[model samples]
Target: MRLFTIGFTQSSAAHFFGRLKEAGVTRLIDVRLNRRSQLAGFAKEGDLAWFARELCGIETEHALALAPTPALLGAYRAGEVDWPEYAARFKRLIARRRIETQLDRARLDGACLLCSEALPHHCHRRVVAEYLRETWGKVEVVDL
Candidate 1:
């Protein structure tokens, strides 16, 4: 399986969509806890879904199971937890949630996980991808 991850922050709309199209991503799985935030601009849930479908012919869906809980995110943002701690907690949360069983394996093929961090280094999307790769095996993760 080819699993891709991407972040929309610090990226222009053109660049974001272009990357997805160039990657041949057939579906975009939004893993944000807050999908309809006004701060998201073009990446807001409704607008993003429409633009992805109309412009890139890509299907979009939200997978809250892949998102960090509100409390976990708050702590990370508040500096109570560092990136390594946050990543560890997130990995544990997903393991408890059994995300490998929750998500459809076939749907992940050619699918890109979406977040708002602008990079995978400190983002939960990377953790999710790596966890899935470890759990499922034979998964090639590409950070787009």
Candidate 2:
């Protein structure tokens, strides 16, 4: 099984949706620390759901399985997190009930982990992708 993780920075919603359709994504796993966005249509969850249904016939879920927290910040700062090491400590912290409580057991056909940062190298989603890859096997990190 291949797990895909990606971020949508300044890319247009229509463009991202099109790419997702081409990618065969059946569901979107949003890993944003905060669900709210300042950008136009992306800010409203209803708008995204509508777009997903009409454009790609896919589904969207704001999964807390990859949330960031203060403890996570501290770990990353202390070097125990190894932000660049790939297998992020943040994933384990997030898996805890206090921060996150889910296994992402949902369907994985063309699944993408969504975040705000378009650049994968600079985004926490990159680390998240790595964690999932190491734990679960094959995984893809798409940055656009």
Candidate 3:
């Protein structure tokens, strides 16, 4: 299965949706702890879902099970936890949650994990993808 990951920061709406379209993303799994944010603009939950469906014909679903806890995210944002620690904790969180079983395997075939980090290098979305690849095997993870 092919699993893609993306971040919306520093990207225009046109570029974001365009990439999704080009990637043939059929579903967008939003792995964000908070779905609503004033700064998200076009990437806000409702707006993003609408645009994804109308423009790219992509289904959108928010999977909080893949997101970090509010405390963990807050600590990371507050500089209490570094990226390494944050990534480790996030990985453990997902492993404990057993997302490999919780998420439908078929839905992820052409799905892309969505976050707001602008890049997947330090994002939890990447961790989630990698975890799935490690556990399930044969998952081609592409960062878009």
**Which runs in model 2 stand beyond 4 Å of their true positions?**
70-92, 95-101, 104-106, 140-144
- Candidate 1 matches the true fold with a TM-score of 0.99
Query: lDDT of all predictions, in order shown?
Result: 0.97, 0.65, 0.94
Select the stronger candidate by lDDT from 1 and 2: 1
> How much is 126 displaced in model 2, in angstroms?
1.9
Candidate 3 clashing pairs? Answer: none
Cα displacement (Å) at residue 39, model 3: 0.3
* Best model per lDDT: 1
Q: Model 3, clash count?
A: 0
Superposed by TM-score, candidate 1 places the C-alpha of residue 113 at a distance from the truth, in angstroms, of 0.2
RMSD of each: 0.5, 4.2, 0.6
Q: For residues 1-144, could you state the per-residue lDDT of candidate 1 as single tens digits?
A: 999999999999999999999999989999999998999999999999999999899999999999999999999999999999999999999999999999999999999999999989999999999999999999999999
Q: How does residue 39 of candidate 1 score in lDDT?
A: 92
